[model samples]
Target: MNINKIKNSKNNFKLIVITAYDALFAKLFEKESHMILVGDSLNMSFAGKPDTLSATLDQMIYHTNAVCTGAPSAFVICDMPFGSYINKDEALRNCIEVYSKTQAAAVKIEGGEDRADIIKHLTSNSIAVMGHIGLMPQYVRSEGGYLVRGKTAEDIEQLVKDAKAIEAAGAFSIVLEGVKTQAAREVTQAVNIPVIGIGAGNVTDGQVLVWSDMLGFFEDFKPKFVKRYLMGGEAVRKAVKQYAQEVQNGIFPSKEEEY
Candidate 1:
């Protein structure tokens, strides 16, 4: 079965994508989600890095391999880490490495118009592709920070151009990040392919979140778009506080494992 067809078919089935860093989560989610993205968001969510730029190709490949193993049948896609796709040859090489090493159905890169050449090169070689637009974290330096894009008419049109270019360049789908509500809808409607939204509102083909963010694992930082599903950080703190109190009172363990 063609994975790309799943995104375009009249089934009207909403694609569900989740970032899977390890085999366990991949195995668990594969059966449920339409796709599993071995996202480099692992930089912030897992490795405590400031953002996605910190994730290396090696680390990304390792997780991609793990996630693919768990997702025997799901469409697996790996994110090509920052700088891996700067030079044309390097981009192709990285795609080949992850495609061969992880057995992922596709690979996602953060760009729209500029990376159009890279997109064409990879897809031509039979590697499926996914496009990421909007708040590209990899461009944090050029963007001056991780703020939203396409607020003005000119910016919005430029965004639309980028999205279209990526789509026309053979990206099976585009990732619409941190854009206004109406603009997100326009892009989705305008593009024939899928648009996976993060902070881009709900009218797109799908929605995704970093697992840690949704679970509230990072207490010190929370993005505006993330809806906390579980307060893991809070729970951990409470448990640690309780353990400290028990240890101080000399009541820890309490003979639970005593012979």
Candidate 2:
């Protein structure tokens, strides 16, 4: 799947993106999601870390490889983990490794205008880049904590500028996370590239969610934007409890045990 298809999907339909850290969930996402992201959120979702800042490039590459194998026909984007792309040369080198090792369609970096030069460098080297703005998880410690952005007029102005800069830098699409609805709408209209939202509301070009959050697998915490479709944690507990009971009661195997 070409990244251009995703770029062209704007305004036609709401592009669906879901994060997957392994082959099982990636295969499931392939059935419906337009794109599967090997997001740094996996640090929390898969590794039980406190936040995305702990994710490493090797972890991202390992998961991206799994996603690529599971969703061979789906467009896959891997997140450039924290500290992986702090400079142009470093960004290019790491992105190239990610692309070559995983065969993912693109690499997503969390930043706005500050990352334009890096984005330009990556694109110049034939690497596709996806931009992320608003409440960057990688910057959470510096920003103080998770918070919604674009509340004030000045903030909205900066957001629009950032979106344009990202587009100008050659990003095919941008993820607007934890942005106010009006600001998200403004950014979506401000740029020709697609804007995918997460807690940024429905006015953007598309929506994305961490697969574990959506499926109710991450029971420790839930964000306001996430709408759990299934109580997977509960379901798994129930199944496990039943199995344990069956085994203790000698109900396992039954007549089929003869086989």
Candidate 2, residues 127-169, lDDT tens digits: the string is: 8899999989999999999989999999999999998988999
Instruction: Tell me how candidate 1 scores on lDDT.
Output: 0.84
Q: What is candidate 2's CA lDDT for residue 176? A: 98
Worst 10 residues of 1 by lDDT: 1-10
lDDT of 1 by residue, 174-231 (tens): 8788998777887888788888889988888888887778888877788899999899
> In angstroms, what RMSD does candidate 2 have relative to the true structure?
0.9
RMSD of each: 2.5, 0.9
Query: On a 0 to 100 scale, what is the lDDT of residue 20 in model 1?
Result: 86
Scored against the true structure, residue 11 in model 2 reaches a CA lDDT of 83
In the predicted model 2, the residue pairs found to clash are none
